[model samples]
Target: PFPSVALVGYTNAGKSTLFNRLTGAEVMAKDLLFATLDTTQRTIRLPQGRPAIIADTVGFVSDLPHELVESFRATLEEVGEADLILHVRDIASPDSAAQAKDVEAVLEQIPTPDGKTRRILEVWNKIDLLEPETRETVVGQAERLAREGTAAAVSAWTGEGIEALRDTIASLIDDDPETQLTVEPHRGDLLAWLYANGRVTGRETDDDGRVHLTVRLHPAALGRLERLYPDVID
Candidate 1:
């Protein structure tokens, strides 16, 4: 399975807009509550042609009903299974911090499959709405957050700070394991995937027409490569 990301946040935090911005998939990104009721996913290609699946989930609200909870089991499950979680926040909202707590309250109920603390990257969305003074503060905070791979400030609407956001996401999820593998000349498809999904440090073609490659890949990508071409590594 591809590495996965889930977008979770309070209603009208611009999570859906950010989702569309990242994945280039047009799902409902309206101002209405619960505009994205179901979990929608699309493949997102990162800076190096590495791909991951990103899911846009239903927006969270304060005091969600128990009955409403049952209706969103799938969305909850999808969030639980994510390799990374982007907690989108409406930075311009007066109650943004409180809303973040509300969303976290619900997230605490959903157990991750691995029983480890989930890696959540805070996304400060709708920065375009911030006043100039407030924007300066948020930008400073974002820069600090970016250093730790913990947060990003962006206006998904204007596409501002998106490239930086992508770089942050890549860094946060990187496994960075390097490997050596040889590919038969016949399996050029596998060769292409390795170059796309990984950093190829060395390459050589033998008289036998096999391509030897020294590559650094994320663990998830490496596992997928191994599964896709079992003979390459041996």
Candidate 2:
């Protein structure tokens, strides 16, 4: 199992857009409120080539009703269990700062899996909607924040500054180590699983029907593979 990332923000803040941009998922991203009610999970490769689970949860609303919170307890729990929390904000919105405050307020009420609030990285999204001069100012601010390792600025619609955002995520959760493995041709299934779950840097086939691979895998994936193909992994 890979570490999970949860996207959290106020309603209509482009959290869903960023989710789709990062994971290639098709979750609805609309201009209206409450577009996504339930939580959605998707697998994606980090910039460093490690696989991870990315989750998009229902948007946060100021003074959210206790009844609705209770109704979506399961969905909101995903935020608490996340290894990383991305606070997506609509930078172009007039209430962007207030929206961020609201998101933080909701996060405070969550009981995280680790019994503490996870570290949050601000995602200043919707830069595409900014005016030229304003966009330049915002971009500079984002760059400064990124240098401090606190935020990333991006346009989910126009795909601007997305690579930088991905790199930031990769740097945050990149504690996994690389390993080499050798599998027989008959174990094609294993090869496919490795490709899907790990980052395969190189592969070669020998005349003896052996496939050699260099891969970077999360510890959980590495352990599982070792257990399944003990003799194959070096």
Candidate 3:
């Protein structure tokens, strides 16, 4: 499976717009708050030829209601499962900073997998709405995060700074443990499982009915496959 990255932020913070821009999917983006009530997932292809799964979740709010929060636990769990977190913010929003803080608070409440702190890259979004000087200032602030090792800025509507964001995501995902594995034809069940849980790079079937497959899988999947198909791999 493709690695996942979640787009999170306060309601009406342009998270949905950015999600649409990145995934080319239509999942209902509007100017109103809380446009998304559930988690929506789509596939994204990065410039480095690697693919990732992007999840757009319900927008967060300050002092969120317990009922609402409880109802969205499964959706919020998507954030915990993410390989990366794109903290999208509407830079022009007067409460942008406060909104970001609120988002951070909600994220803190979620349980992370493997006890690993979710890697977050703040995205100071909606730059097109800012004045030139303000835009530069915001960019500088976001660049400071990069300097200190954390954030990025972009205008999802205008597609500005998207390339930089994509590149950063590529770098982050590449740093994870990924191994190339080869599979045999008769192991169709294993092959299917690998394709579902890993990224297949190449596959071919020989005249002898053996299959040749190249895949990039997480260490866990690789280990399971090895235990199951010792005779098929090199």
Candidate 4:
């Protein structure tokens, strides 16, 4: 499986817009509430050429009904299984902070298989709607979060600050132990899997009919591919 990042936030927070921007997928990103009710998964190519699975989930709401939350189990499960969480927030909204808190509360209820919470990267989005002074304040807060090692900022609508966010995510994913892998050409399927799950950095073909490939992939995917193609790696 490819490394996954979950786009989560309160309704109308631009999570879906950001999802479309990052993945280049055409999911419905309306300004209305609950525009996205189910989890939508799309393959995204990072700036570094690495592949990641980006999932856009239903927006979280304060005082949301238990049944409503439960109905999104399959969608929420993506969060539990993700390697990173993009906590998208509407920086322009007056209740943005409160909405973020609501999202956090919902995230708290997601159960992971290893009993460990996913890494969350707070993303203050929609800066295009903020005034100059408020934008400065919001940008300062985002910088502070970066300094404190917690979050980042971006304008999904205008594509501002997106490069920084992508770089940050790339760094985080690179730190994961599961993403390092080596492959040889004999394992065509493993090569395909690597291409799907990670970025292929280098490849060379030897005179002896062997192909060598260097890839950075999620650990789970690497392990599974290795088992399927034991002779692929030297």
> Compared with the true structure, what per-residue lDDT tens digits does model 4 show for residues 101-192?
88888888878878655788989898889899989998988988876547888999899988888878876666534333445446667667
Instruction: Compose the digit string of candidate 3's lDDT tens values, residues 1-234.
Output: 467899999888889888988888887888766789888988877864567889999998897776777788999989989999989888899999898889888888888988776789888889999999998998988877776448888999999988888878877775545554455556678777766666666667778876676666666666776787665555
Best by TM-score: 1
Clashing pairs in 3: 1-197, 1-198, 185-211
* Residue-wise C-alpha lDDT for candidate 1, range 33-62, written one tens digit per residue: 899888898988776655678999999999
Better of 1 and 4 by lDDT: 1
* Angstrom error at residue 91, model 3: 0.8
Which sequence of candidate numbers ranks them by TM-score, best first?
Answer: 1, 2, 4, 3
The backbone clash count of each candidate, in order, is: 0, 0, 3, 3
Candidate 2's displacement at residue 25, Å, is: 3.1
lDDT of each: 0.86, 0.86, 0.81, 0.80
Clashing pairs in 2: none
Instruction: List model 2 lDDT by residue over 71-146, tens digit each.
Output: 8899988888888899999999999999888888888788876565587889999998999999999999989989
TM-scores of the candidates in the order shown:
0.87, 0.85, 0.79, 0.82
- Considering TM-score, which of the candidate structures 2 and 3 is the better prediction for this target? 2
On lDDT, the stronger of 3 and 4 is 3
Cα RMSD (Å) per model?
Answer: 2.7, 2.7, 4.4, 3.2
